[model samples]
Target: MSRVAPLAPPWSKQDADGINRWGHPDRTYEPLLLVRCLQRHPALTAKLRALGEALYVDATLPPRLRTIAILRICALLECAYEWGGQAAFWGPIAGVSEAECDALVTGADVGWSAEERTLISAVDELEATGSWTEQTWTALGGNLTDEQRMELLIAVGWYRTICTLCNGMDLPVEGWMRPWPG
Candidate 1:
């Protein structure tokens, strides 16, 4: 993972009216997730950061549902870094136990809730064939609140975009960049 000098103005902790890098991992002096995150256009950076916070923190959607969607997305994309990042959340935040995460690791054993099954099946159908089946939508019971719906779509799109960037950039997985020989 070779480091590149910034091609544009770097946001200081002084940026964002004082929120600093912790509030914005992309604004950190170094790239936190994807190398492209460091070089992303300012507008996209803000949107991605907002989506990151929404996906991980806001809980506008049920954490379990959001995490499950992310897991399925990461698996679909074969984005190992994204999967590693998303998988770490199965316990502390999503209330999903290690046993469930283990089962999902194989996919053949997803043993999901009725709602979780509907969401994952929809995501899979959409990813594979570019749309959800009518039956899949019918099974999408009214479990998600309205706010959850908005954030969930945005969150899915957000990570999918990042997955594209990270893979296209050939960004090393986080630990692969550590103890940098360069």
Candidate 2:
């Protein structure tokens, strides 16, 4: 069971519109425990929904680069719910091979090119120190455009927030999705 049980019944009805908006396109929130919990607060849910669309759904970062940062954050935080769903759905579409997704669980440096490795390193630094070191900043500058660099930082911060929510709420992975590396 989740540490924080999702809202039920009348509470759910309280934010039906918000629920419909943020809920799955198929009208199912069974797998998205975070949305279930957030639905209780309609205003907050809308804000979160917009933020999510901006970060992941309508992101400007290359699909591969975005997935790499997201998966790295998921792995770092051990947010299996996020990792499982993202790896299964977005990873392949974003050009991250199954092997690469599996390897992300070990560390960001595994099986990635120098540029990608540096991107992962940036995530690590941000998670650890809340900012990238000067060395990593320089390495990243060589490969990423100012826009991509900004997107990378935003993506890292966003995914880490998601990791916190999933971990804190104990959101369950959907039945159809499996965590990376089994």
Candidate 3:
């Protein structure tokens, strides 16, 4: 059971506004458990939503690279809620294969390109040390523009924060989401 019960639908006008404002504008609102949990603090939710938009919509980082970093981070953090959601929804759309997703979890050598390997390595380093080594930074610079590097760093931090919230709450995977791959 989730430590904090997610607010159910048939929401108040205030909640509907918050959800609409923070959620992906392109997708129909579905009262995701995470969103409902955040609704408890509407103001903070709004702030987080803005940052989320910046990372997801406005950032210079390529969507495929961003999704890869997110998947690696979620796997490293063992946040099944975020991991499963990203793997099921964004992974295929972003061209991240099932084998790659499993490799992120298992640290298998899955024939990622050199750039992709560097990205995964960077995420692993960040999770382990909270800072990138000089070599990883240099490798990242070779593959990503300055703006993209900055965005990647922020994305890592952002997803880590999300993982913390989901894991701390023991949030259940949505029924529509794929659970952690065995």
Candidate 4:
């Protein structure tokens, strides 16, 4: 059970707005547990949701790279709620293979291309040290524009914040979401 239960409907206008504005199409109202829990703090929900939209919708980082970073971050944090939801929904849409998702969870060696390898390594480094090494930054530069690099860093921090929320709240994976891959 979640430490803080998700707020159910008859939502305040503010929460309804936040839900309408920020809810992920796949996750929302399949009970919307996370966003509804967040609606407990409406102001923060709005801001966080907006940031999420910026990262997922408006950012320059490619969707595939962003999804990879999210998977790695959630795996490292052991946040099953976020990891499962993303793996089930966004991962395939972003072309992240099941093998790749399993590799993320188990740290298995996979035949990822050079760019994919660098992105995984970068997420690992960030999880370990909270910043990328110069070598990793240089490697990223080959494939990512400056804006993309910045967005990647922000995505890392943003997803970490999300994982913290999911894990700390003891939020259950939605019934529709894939469970954590072995």
Going through the candidates in the order shown, the clash numbers are 0, 0, 0, 0
lDDT: which is higher, 1 or 4?
A: 4
Candidate 2 stretches greater than 4 Å from native = 9-16, 23-31, 108-110, 180-182
Which candidate tops lDDT?
4
lDDT-wise, the better of 2 and 3 is 3
Q: Give the Cα-based TM-score of candidate 4 against the true structure.
A: 0.93
Lowest summed lDDT across 10 adjacent residues in model 4 is found at 22-31
Better of 1 and 4 by TM-score: 4
lDDT of 3 by residue, 89-148 (tens): 778878988888878888888899989988998999999999998899999999798889
lDDT of 4: 0.86
**Order of the predicted models by TM-score, top scorer first:** 3, 4, 2, 1
lDDT, candidate 1, 12-63, per-residue tens = 5434322233233433234444534443455556656665766666666777
Worst 10 contiguous positions by lDDT, candidate 2 = 22-31
| Alpha-carbon RMSD, each predicted model | 5.6, 2.8, 1.5, 1.6
Q: Of the candidates numbered 2 and 4, which has the greater lDDT value?
A: 4
Better of 1 and 3 by lDDT: 3
Q: Write the per-residue lDDT of candidate 2 for residues 24-94, one digit (tens) a residue.
A: 36433343667677776668778878887777566678889889889989998998888887787777778
CA lDDT, candidate 1, residue 66:
76
